[model samples]
Every structure is written in structure tokens, then in C-alpha cells.
Target: MADLKQGSASHQHEAAAVIQKHFRRYQAQKRYKQQQSATSTIQQHASRFLARRQAARDNEQEQRAARFQAVMSRHHERIQQLELEKRAIKQLGAGELEAWQARREAAATTIQAHWRGSRQRQQLKLSHPALATLRPVACSSPQPADEPSCSTRPISSKVPSNHPLLHSVTAAGVTGLHAEPSTASVAAWPAHRAGLEQQPSSASVCSGVGYSSRAAAMHGALRGEASSCLSAEASRLSAVGAAAQQPADAPRRTAALPAARRMVLERQVQLRTDAFKAAPNALAAARATQQESDQRLVHLLEQHTAAAAERLKAAQRRQKLLQDAEALHSQLQQLPQLSQLPDNVTGAHFALPGACGARAQRSRQAHALALAEAKVGSKWWLPLKALNQQLRDAAAAAEQDAGSTSGSASKAAAGALWGAAGSTGLLQQDWQQQELMWKDSWQRIREEEQQRPGLQELMQQDQALRPHVVIEQELSSESSWHAASMQ
Candidate 1:
């Protein structure tokens, strides 16, 4: 009985163990299933969240793209309009091109002068030594009208006192003139020496010959000899004069030295005159060259002027065109967000803005603006074209404004015109308030128009609507569909 009980207990214990094991296994499986269910729910929720997030992101991007497209479209349209304006502006204002050319020529002329000055300086250096020697002595020495005032000069300290007559004429004044030479005689010696120096001594000797027969022959020879001797004596007298004028302590002149010094002075003067006459042909040629240069300069200036005028005109035309383009772009900016606009609404109701005073075709403006506005949606945005147009328009408008109130007459006219236009609104009032801002500037446009009927015609052809016109359209779009006008 004990064994059986024990066996039953063992069996119960084993069965209990088996049931416990099975329960444990079942609990583990149920736990695992619950874990999987929880994991799946988490994954599903995460997926839903991800999908919603992606959708939201996509919508945001789409909105951004739409706005970008509209901006880009506006830009492209503005570019095209500006391009048209640029073409028209290029056609107007003939003087602007001339002015530009003149500026270029002036610049070239300035450069040429700089180079010429540099070349002249270089030449001055090279010729300085020769010029120094040839330059006339300053008349610093006080003159005494009587006695042919020979200024006492310092003989060139360069020549040794022992030097021969071949020394510089300037340094050794007529050291050989008269026994008690007056100052006037010394001054006159240089001019007189210049005339007599080259003459043969035979002429002076012949002038003193005697005229008897048998005694005449002998007398003639003797007279000739005596005349030679007298000439020699005269030459000696000039030397004595030169020596006398020297400082009291200086050495006395030898009799023969005077004649030699006189000969030297005479030779020096002859050389100067010869030099003066030597270059007639060169002077004539230089005059001819200068004349030719003058003619060339005149011709070149005329060509430069004409070319400059043409360039100025083109620039003015471009400015006008840009003004029109700016006006158009500004108008585009004023337009309501296309994304906010209903698809049912056509772009035609929008007014086209111009940088100039002229109006463009509404249909064309619509397409251009719409296309520009649409480009913003694309991945790549090209703002260059639009920005360029904007810049051009602003420039043109500035020019026009400057012209309108630059002068007293212009200011008066502008005031009258504004009064006639009548500031009816806040915006017009704002413009009027700002009109005084540019009161002093003279605009080429108005000046041209006022002075020349042809210019006015050209301006009419080139000018477009004001850049502010675009804002007018946007501000009025709610109540009225504003159309840009050509008038």
C-alpha cells in the first residue's frame, strides 16, 4: 500500500511537472505573439506617421515651387520686355553716343600727352649739356650806355694763365684791344673781331703801299713792309688793352699776345653766324610736319566725335528700354500671388509695367509675365535676366526723372504737368512728394524732347510706361482690371 501511494505521488509529481512545462511553453508562445502584435502596431503607426509627414513636406514644396515659378515667370517676362526696350533705347539719343566717343578720345589724348611729356623730359636731359653752352649770358651786368659798357667778366677759371690764344673766346675777352681801352671798346671788340678775323692779312698790308717811280719801287716795298709792321702793331695794341683791364696784380700782356687774342675772338663770332644759317632745310621740314599733325588731329577728332555720339545714343536707348522693363517688373511685383489666384482668371487682367513711358501689348506682357512667374517652380531659378531688366529700368527712370526737373524751366513744366495730372490718391501724393527729390538734375530725355521735334519723335518711339505703373495695377486689381496703355 505504501509503494502504491508512493507510485501515485510520483506519477502526480511527474504529471504536474509536465503540465507546468506545457504551461510555461504556452505562456512563452503567448508572450511572443503579444510582443509581435505590439511590434506590428508600432511599425504601422510609424509608417502612417512617415506617410503623413512626407505628404505635408510635398505640399510645402509645391507651394514653394509655385511661388518660385511665379517669380521666375515674372523675371523672364521682364527680361523680354527689357530686351525690347533696350533695342528701342539704342535707337534714340544721338548725342549720347557722340559724348561717349568724345570721352574716349579725351582719355586717349590725355594718355598721349603724358607720353609726350615723358619723351620731352628725356630729350631735355640729352640736350641739356649743349644747351647750357649755347645759352645767352644773362644781362645781369649793369649797363653803362656810354663807353659801350663792357661788363668785367671772370675769365673761365678753366684756362691756365699760361694757355695760348686757342682758349675759349668767352673766357678770354679781347685781352688784346687798345692801349687805354674804354669799356665800350671792349664790348664792341667781339662783334668787330667776328667781321675781321677771317680776312687775309694781305688786304690790310696792300692798303698801306706807297706810289713813287724808281724811288717808288723801293718805297713801295718799304711801304708794304711798314704796313705789315703797322698791322702787327695794331694787333699788339688790342692785347695791351685786354691786359690793362685785368686786375692790377695780374701779369702784363706781351706785345704779340694782343694780336693773337683778337684773331681768336674774330673766329668765334664767325662760327656762331655759320651755325645759325646751317639748318634752314630742317626748320622747313619741322614746320611741314607740325602742319600735318594738326590736320590729322582735326580729322581724328571729328571721327571720334561722331562715333561717340552714336554710342551715347545707343546707351540712351538702352536706358529707356530698361526703364520700361523696370516698370513692367514692378507691375509684376504688384500683381497678386498667382498661387492665390483662381485658375479661371486669365493673366490678361494684369497690367504690364514698363521702365519707359510707352505701353506694351497686353497679350504679350501676359504671356511673358506668366512664363517668368512659372519658371520659379522649376528646380533651377534664373534671376539674372529679371535682375538685369530691373536694373536697366531703374536706370532709365532715373534719367527721365533727372531730365524732367533738372532746370528752372523743366521744374516749372514738371510742376504744371503734375498739377494737371492731379494727385488724386495716396500713391500719387507720394510721387508728388518725392518729385522734389530730383529737382536739380537735368535729364537728357526731356532736354532732347523739348529742344528737337525730331528728338521728341525719337523719344516717343523709344519711351515706355513708368515703372511705378505696375504698382498702380496691383493696387487697383481688386476693384478694377487695369490695362496698360500705349498713349
Candidate 2:
């Protein structure tokens, strides 16, 4: 019985040892499993963090690329606009210069025509027949009273005769000789008449011897009177006799004396009178012509001055525009390159704020917005809102794509899909379509708003309604509409 009890205890001990060994092995396996689970969790977390970081980096790179592209496009557009402006400026300047030259030529032609007309009128006046006839006579001839005396003298008797018939015959012959008219007679007739009146007349001559001496004295006195009166007549007759002797030498002078002298004096007076009358008329005509020409010249000068001023203003404006374009180009050239800019700069700096701000800032924005609306109209907001919505949609779509991806293979597939979408220009096409739609909507809105009542109408209404105390219902309604539209 002692041997059986000892063997049973030994068997119990072996079973206990086997159970302990099994328990230790089970504890070691539990520890190894826990460690493996912790390692796997850590690795998963690391992979997820790496994916998020890579996505963030890709988003930043895309944003930088988009900004660079936008800047380049804006620069290109500005250059094209500047080139167009320069071409327009050059065309305008050339046109203005040509117009100015044409105007100057026209003015010169007008002035030349005026001068030519004046000169022609003066030449016509100088060439007048009446003036030509009067000119030489007035310049070459002496006064009628200062004419040259004739060369002949009257004869007187040495002894006196006492016969009444002879004395009467002699007196009648002497009076007849003086009565013959001539150029000298016309000049000296008045002096001779005065001298005859001053001399005493002889009563009668006696036929006896004692009357011979008295008759001789009376004959002498009568002879003196006859000599004074007939001097010019006798000389003229002697000249006629001499001209008859030498008719060939002075035939024209002798022939012209009888008819031409009287006619020449009369013609001279008439021509002088006519010329005097015509001179005033010609002078007045010339003065009127000059006045008209001066007025025309003044008007032309005024027009030219106005045109020059307008051209000058246009040139100045073009110069200012060119300067502005050059300045913009220089500024663009001075800017830093996109690749050289800092990478860590927050893209939020480029984002514009909406309505949320401090009170002052909000008021300022509201004021700016109102001004923009007044200038550009209500259509400006449409494109802005559409762009913002498109951006939000793109972000949501990206997030959705990222969330849909699961393990490494799925994530890689999602990345490839995103790359494909970008490479295939799907997002760009959508963005372009959105922009086109926004532009179309903006254009439609702008056109519609332009057809509405403007500030000019409001100002007109204000002026017309100033005197009246009561406001019209139509005006009130329009004002409310305007206020609503502005809001």
C-alpha cells in the first residue's frame, strides 16, 4: 500500500509540470500577438499621415502653378492691349497731322487769291483809258495864261492923214484885224479889253493943215491902242505866213491849232472830272474787297487755331497713354520671377475677403461695392459668385475622391485617377465652361440694366419736380425700384 501512494503523487506532480509549461507557452504567444498588433497599427497610422502630407504638398504645388499661369496670362494680355493702343495712337496722330497740313494749304491758297485779286484790281485802274488821256496833259502842259507869245509885230504909219473916210476905214480895218480869233487871242483878249477901256477915245480928225499935227497925235494914240490889241493877232498871222512858207516842217502844229486846242481843253476837263469820280469809286471798291478778304482770313485763322488746339490735345493724350503703357511694362519687368518667389508664403494672402470684417472695413467695402455697381452695373457679381461656387465644388470633389480610396492599391489608383483627370483637361474644361457661362450671364445682365432708367433720368426728374411740393406716385415707385436695385 505505501508503494502505490508514492506513484500516485509522482503522477500528479508530472501533470502539474505539464500544465505549467503549457500556461507559460500560452502567455508568451499572447505577448507576441499584442506586439504584432501594435506594430501594424503604427504602420497604418504612418501610411495615412504620409498620404495626407503628400496630398497637401500636391495642392500647394497646383495652387502655385495656377497663380504663375494666371500671372503670365495677365502679362500677355496687357502687352497685347498696349500694342493695340499704340497702333491706334499712331493712326490718330497721322490723321491729325494730315488734316493740319491740308488746312494750312487751304489758308495759304485763300491768302494768295486775295492778294492776286487786289493786284489785278490795281492794274485795271492804272490801265483805264480816261486816266491815261488825262495823265500826260496834266504833266506836260503849262497853264493857259503862261503860253508863249507869237513872233510877229503890228505896223504903224510915219505921217498922219486928215481924211474922215481914211480914218474910219483904218479904224474898221484895225478892229477887224484884232477880231480874228487864235490861241494867243484866247489868252490875251481880257488884258487887251482892260487896256482899251483905260485909254481916251479921239473925237474926230480935221481935213485942214492945222489939223494935220493933231490928227498925227490922234493917229499915234490910236496906233498904240491898235498895236496892243492886235499884237497877238498880228503875230499869229505872221506865224501862219511862216508856216505856209515852211509847211512841211510845222504842218501838224499849224493844222492842230485851229481845231485841237479848244477840243483838247474841253476833253481835259471832262476826263479830269470823270477820273476824279472814278477814283473814289475804285478806292471804295478796293476797300470793300480788302475788308472782305481780311474777314475771311480772320475766320480761316480762327478755324486753323481751333484745329491745331484740338490736334495738340489729342497728341498730348496719346503721349500720356504711351507713357502709362511703358510704365506698366517696366513695372512688370521689375517684378520677381514666379520660380524665385518663396514657397512658404500662405496662399490665403491672395484670397479676397467677403462681407465679414470690422465695422469700418465693412463700410468701406460696401461703399466700394456700391461704386463698382454704379460704374460696372449689377452684372459684376455674377462671375465672382460662379467662380467661388466652382472652387467649392472642385474642393468637395477632391475630398470625395480622397475619401473613396482605401488601402495602398486603392490610394494609388485614386492618385492615378486624379492625375488623369487633371492631365485630360477635364477640370480645365469645366472651369472654362463656368467662365463662359458667367461671362454670358454678365453680358445679358449688363445689357438689360443699360436699358433701364439711368442717373440722367433721375436727375431730370429731380429738376422737373423741384417746384412742386407733392411727389408723383410714378416717381416714388421708380425711386423705390432704384433703391432696391442698388441694395
Candidate 3:
């Protein structure tokens, strides 16, 4: 056992070393690839930025030219406001736009309030079972005419003490059973029960049956034993009911009965109550049978469902993998010849920086809020905006100081003796396991761009083509053009 332990430890160490070797190799390859791509990625980002800046400059020039047009619009609006004032229309009075908006807001609020009230009332009706009784009930329409019905009134009577199954239903149907039996059932079942309850007067009752049953119910883990307990209790109950029906003078000799007869009698037990069988007002027997059968099936299936579901999921996963493999094999010619690295440095290694940097966030919410409150009619309003901006920049600088790897790297190198095992070294995992072992993300994105539909074909057909636009000059010059009616 000592040798075996040593051998296993050696094997584990060997596995760890091999894993580290592969990880280091992958890391070196990744770093080299990043170095190669950094130039191009940075260039692309720089070009995009410069293009956007140029576009913004052009937009500013166009806006300057449109200023004269805006002045003309203001003049046109003043003329319309003056003309409306002369009319003295109620809706067209002072603060006309505000009034229209207020009326619209009021109408919307009223509609929403009415909808909520109606919904709440409906929900209240559904929630209360008593309300269902007050609502007029028609005779049941179709489907299982023999099924139990409570008629217009729910059951509220007390059931026999011997019948536990029917007890709760008789009181208030809280057990979700029939409130009333079907037309075929006997409303009074005690007479039939009285016959089955008879047992030999000389025989003794089973001792501690009630205590054993109660204890088992409270703590028993065995399901089959619980059912046996139920059967035993039923037989005991039937014998009890029979005792009341028989005369005290009547004699029953247990010794006179044949061995076979006695054996059959001993084994015989009533499975159900008379009320439960051939229910006249409902299919109580069928429902009970179905319920038992369902419970049994559920119990049986519960043992195997988890294993079966796991197998099914595994099979589906394998099928998907195979399908993906086949598709890739078929489209080999269209696929990328080489894997490209992402220039984005965001990865698990940044987690420490994120945690450490939280002390210095961009928000100066309290200061900004104070400035906002004091801004109205203050000479320092212009300076308040600048103060808010200055605080934000200061916070950014502090965050850079807190979260940066540059400062930490120097400190870490100084303490290299104590911190030899780095985040990606002996302490942490081999690599972040992503698609194609961290390969597919960049390649797939590139492939999607290259194979993007329509644009390439359109460029080939007419490379000089540019989409033409015809803006309505009147609409741009006048905001009220939206209210224009067609002739």
C-alpha cells in the first residue's frame, strides 16, 4: 500500500508536468501571434477613428450652412403663433403644447387605471372559491356524464369517522376530490360496510396496529411497508364495523372452519369502501383506480427517469457534435487555412485588476448632483459642468493608478523569490478553455465577414454605385411639415 501510494503520487506529478509543458507551449504561440497582429489591429482602429472625425467635421460644416434655414423656421413659427392668438381658441391658448400634452397624459392615465381595476377584480373573482358558488352554474355539458358533480352547492357535511378518504371531501372538497358522488352511487354506504366488518367474535384484534401505523407514517422510509400498513388498518376497520352489526349472543367458532377456509379468510382484505365502488353520481372507482395506477407508475418511473434523461441528453450532444464535424468536413475548402489571434486583451487575467480598481470608479455622483442643484441662476453654472468633468477625469486617473498591471508587475518582480508561482504558472489552470481551445472566435468572425451575402456581389456588378437619397427640403426647413395633409 505504501509503494502503491508512492506510484500514484508519481503518476499525478508526471501528469501535472506534461500539462504545464503543453500550456507553456500554447502560451508562447499565443503571445507570438498577438505580437504579429497588434500592428494591424491598431492601424485599423486608428483609421476608423480618423474617418469618423472627418465625417463629424463635414457634418459641422453642413450644420453651419443650415443655420440660416433654422432662422427662417423660427420666423415662420412666430407668424403661426401670432395668427393662433388672434383666433382665441381654447386649446390654442397660452402654453398650448403643454396643455395638449397634459390632456393626453390625463386620458392615458384614466385608461390605464380602468384597465388595472378591471384586471384586479377579475383576479379577485378567480382567487376566491366561494365566489365560484355565487356565479350561476349551468348543468355539466358533456364528457363523462357519470363523473361526480357537486351540483350548484359544494359539500359541507361531515363524513363517517371510519372513512378517512371521504372525510375531507365531505367537509369542503379541500382534498380536490368529488364533493358529491355520481347517480349510480349509494349516498349512504354504512349499511353495506356493516356487512363486511364482521369478524370471528373469539379472535383477538391485532395489537399495537394503530401505534405502529402512526409511527411508520411519521418516520417510515419504506413505501411498500406503508401500503401494507394501510391494508392492515383497512381490515381492522372492517372488523370493527362488523362488530357493531353482529349480536352479542351470536357464536362464531374459529376451530370449526376448515384450514383452507381459515387461510382464505385470513388473507382476504377489503381494498375499498362501498362509496368508492360504482359511484352513481361520479366515476369514483375509475378515478381512484387511475389515481393508484398513476401513483404506482410514477413510483416505478422515478427510479429510472434520471438515468434515461441523462442518456438521451448525451446522445443528443454526440449527434450535434457529429453533425458539426460533418459540416466542417464538407466545407473544408471554404474554411480558414490559419487561426488568427484576437488583439483584445480582455481575459481571466484581468479579474484581479477589476477587483482592485473598484475604489476608483468614474462616478462623482454626489458632487455632480450638488452642482446640478446649485446650477439654477448661479454665476458658477459654467464652472459646475467643468468641475463635474474635472472630478470624473481625476477619478479615471485614480482608477488607472489602482487597476494597472504595470505598477504591480514591478512590485511582483521585486518579490520574485516569494511569488514565483504566478497566476498562469503552477498556481492556476493551463488555459481558459474556449472554442477550438481558444481559436474559433476570431476565425469564425473573419469567415462570417468574408462570406457576408449580397454586398460583395453588388460591388462586383456595379463598384461605382452609391445609394441616392431625396430628402424633402420643406420638411428639413420646417418642423411643422409632419402635420402636412396630402391634397
Candidate 4:
């Protein structure tokens, strides 16, 4: 494998070039196919979009053409209607004036109703100039013939169609159509019309028309029609009545369109400033305060440091006292407690602060000094000192005298002292054993006092928890005989 790898390494660059060339060709072909597919997708989407847009445009054009056609048809129809109306008006007799009034009044009423309904549906008081344009209209529904109009216009008795009054009203249209009147009332036409108006309603009059009032008024000036003249006069009267009724300062219903409300927002910006910035001495005062605080802090820190040092010194003093006491206690153990010296056994003497043995914790190492004076006193301090003094003297005398008498004296005194010390050691051990036994008994008693309730108090558990069934039965002969015997 190593040889093959070594050989292949030499051709690595050439193989990589060939691999890269093929990969590049593959990538180019893939990219070309992808781009072509994407282009085809884009073309399909564009064509669909254009088709839809064109279809929409065509539909819109068709709808517009239909609406235009409808509008033109209506326009032509209205024109034809107006032309027919003109001819009809030219031929209208006095009776036909009522019909024209009815139609005009209906138009005005329709405009008012549309205005009112529009306002109500929108829930708004719309101020329209168009509302004021048509102030007068009347109903055309049937009314009883005996009833009177709201204006209290008197009704005249029915007159023949050929009545002279009719001829008088139609005089301008065609002359001599009536019997030659000896004398005619100039107001006959007006009185006749007023009574005819009263025949239409009791409570309401087919009052006047506001329907294309200008056009109606212009057409009323035709020279040949009596109905046209009356219509024009009626329109003039209605206008005068409307002007009288509406006050100049009448409050109008105004429209509240969402667009008309103010859309622009007003803004105001205010920056907060501090009076402290205006004062030149503020910084100086602040620095002085900070310096004062720092000084106070330094003073407090010094006090704390002194206090800490005192506490540490006190702790070290305590540790020194404990070490001294422990060392002296150990030295005292080596000294004989006898009142006299023994002849047989000599006591072991140790120098001051003798070995208390080495401890693994070296937190305090003052004991490294072997002969350093360590002060610790106990109840046996004097006795221990005296024993040490006697031993030193005995050794000195033995060295000086070198006689059998001196040696014998040292031995007797040391032996008696050590014997007493042995007696005292026996008492100490005995007391320690007794103390341990008492402590153990006390611990046992305390443990026995902690009673567990469940172990002792689970009485009548079965009868209290289990279900029971009543058994009705005769007593057995043996149980009855036992009960009789007990009684």
C-alpha cells in the first residue's frame, strides 16, 4: 500500500487535473440544463401572465363597450321621450296641466327620498346642495272627491267639458272655440285651476314640481299651451314658498367623509435639561465630596486593619498557650510523683518543653526550637520542679563523691517516689475506666428513651379495619353448660 501511494502521489496533480476537467464539464452541462429548464419555466409563467393580463384587458374593454352602449341607448331614449313630451305639451288642454304637475312633483319627491335614504343608510348627516334644490313635491295617490287640499283651496262644482271657463282658459290656443261671452271674469281661469287643484287631495296638494325646474319653466313659455302657462306659474309659486320657509342661517347636515378629516400629524419635540449642568462649581463640589468619602474610607480601612491584626495576635497567643500547656503536661509525665527518692528505680528527667511527640499538622512550628523556654504551669508544677531539682542534685553528688553511701541514698529516695507515682497512676486508670462505663450507660439510657409509636401501639388493628358479617345461630351445648357453671 505504501509503494502504491508513493507511486500515485507522483501522478496526483495530473489525475487531479483530469478529474477537475471532467467535473467542470459535468458542472457546465448541469448548469446549462438547469438554466434552460429555468428559462422554460420563466417563459411558461410569462406567457400565462401575459395571457391572463390580455384576457383581463379584453374583458374590461368588452364591459366598457357594453356600458357605453347602454348609456347611449338611455341617452337616445331620454331624447326621444323629451321630444314626445314637447309635442304633447304643445297640444295639452287646461286639464292636462294637472298631469304635468303630477309627473314633475313625483320626480322631485324621488330625488328627496333618494337623498334621505342615502343619508340614513350611511348614518350620517350629509350636507348636500342638491337637497335644497328640490324643496317642493306632492303626492298623486287617489283622494275622495269631497275632500279638500291642505291649502284650503275651494272646490268648484263639476263644469261641462265645453264650459265657457274652459274655452276662456284655452283662448290663446285657438280663438272662438267657446261661445262668445258677454263679459268674462279675468280670474276665472285661476279660480278654476285652484278648485281643480283642491280635487286632488284633502290633506296634501299635488303642489309643484322641482324636476328639471329650469327646463320645465323654459318649456312652460310655449305660446300655445294653457297647461304650460299654469305649470310655469306653479313652479314660480313653489320656489317663492321654498325661499320663504328656509332660513338663511339654517344649519345643514354635513358629511364626515374619512378623507376630509385632517390626515397630517403634528409633532413637537422637547429636550430635558438639568440645572446642575449650568453650575460651574458642581464638578468641583462633587470631586471634593468624593475625596472626602475616600479619606473616610481610608480611615475606616486603617481601623479595620489594626483590629484584624489584634485579633490574629490574640489567636496566636491562644495557640502558644495551648502548646506550652501541652508541652509541660508531657514533661510532667516523665517526673516521679513520690515524696521520696527510690533506691531501685530512678526517675526519668526531661528538660523544659520536652518532646510532646511530632504531629503531622505543622500549622504552628514554634516547637522546632528544642530548648526554647515555654511557660506552662499545672497543679503539679511545684512537685515536678522539685523532682527535677532532686535528680539534678543526685547526679551531681554521684559525680562529686563517687561513694557507695551517696549512691544508696539516691536509689532509696527515687524508688520511694516512683512507687508512690505508680500507685497514683493505678488510681487514674481505675477512674478513667469507671468514667467510660458511666458514659456508655448514659448513652444507652438516652437511646432507649426514643420510643417508636407503631411498634408498641398497633392494638386492635384487625377489628378496626376488617369488615364483619352477623351470624344468627343457636348456642352450642358445651358453651351453654360452661356459662351455667360460671353463673
Highest-scoring model, lDDT: 2
Local distance difference test, each candidate:
0.47, 0.49, 0.42, 0.42
TM-score of 4: 0.19
Residue-wise lDDT of candidate 4 within 143-205, one digit each (tens)? 333221111211112224553333443453423322221212322444555765654321121
Worst lDDT run of 10 residues, candidate 2, spans 150-159
For candidate 2, give the lDDT of residue 410: 39
Model 2 stretches astray by more than 4 angstroms? 1-256, 260-265, 336-487
For model 4 the local lDDT of residue 307 reads: 100
Cα deviation in Å at residue 318, candidate 3? Answer: 42
TM-scores across all candidates?
0.23, 0.27, 0.14, 0.19
For model 4, what is the C-alpha lDDT against the true structure?
0.42
TM-score of candidate 1 versus the correct structure, residues matched by position: 0.23
Between prediction 1 and prediction 4, the one with superior lDDT is: 1
State the lDDT of candidate 2 residue by residue for 59-120, as single tens digits: 99999999999999999999999999878767787778789779999999778766665665
Clashing pairs in 2: none
- Cα lDDT of model 3 by residue, 380-410, tens digit: 2333334334433444454466666564553
List the candidate 1 regions with Cα displacement exceeding 4 Å: 1-257, 303-307, 330-487
For model 1, state the Cα shift of residue 72 in Å. 48
Tens digit of per-residue lDDT, candidate 1, span 384-405: 2233233334444544667755
lDDT winner between 1 and 3, please give it.
1
Give the candidate number with the greatest TM-score: 2
Q: Candidate order by TM-score, highest to lowest?
A: 2, 1, 4, 3
Residue 104 in candidate 1, Cα distance off native in Å: 43
